[model samples]
Target: MKVERQKDEIVVRFSAGKNASKIQSILDYLRYEELTSKSKATQKDLDLLLKETKRGRFDKIIIEMGLDEKDYR
Candidate 1:
């Protein structure tokens, strides 16, 4: 395997006998990093967003199951 920096991008050259699944997982991570690199949100913002989303889903589940709100609260 060989790696080089080409302009603002990276070029990785692997011989034919590479593990495809590991390469795919690495590519997926790089794609995620690229997608979030310009984000302005903080960790606190993500935590609150996750909390609210979880609460909303739980609220929906409780209504569907006809469970008492007091039981969950």
Candidate 2:
């Protein structure tokens, strides 16, 4: 693999023989890093978001299964 910077962009060059899925996975991680580099979110905000997401999923599952809140308690 060869990486170079030309003008304002960084270019990556690789052989076609390389695994496509592996290359895609690396690109995905790089994209995530590039996107999050400018983010102002804190760990606390992430934790709260995760908590709410889990609670929403759990509530949906409970309702779908015909289960009451006290049943799980």
lDDT by residue (6-65, candidate 2, tens digit) is 999999999987598899999999999999999999999999999999999998899999
Lowest lDDT sum, 10 consecutive residues, model 1, at 12-21
Query: Using TM-score as the measure, which candidate wins?
Result: 2
Error of 2 at 70 (Å): 2.2
| True-structure RMSD, every candidate | 2.8, 1.8
Tens digits of per-residue lDDT for model 1 on 1-73? 8999999999998776659779889989999999999999999999999999999999999999999988998
Q: Each model's TM-score? A: 0.71, 0.79
TM-score quality measure for candidate 2: 0.79
Candidate 2 CA-lDDT value? 0.93
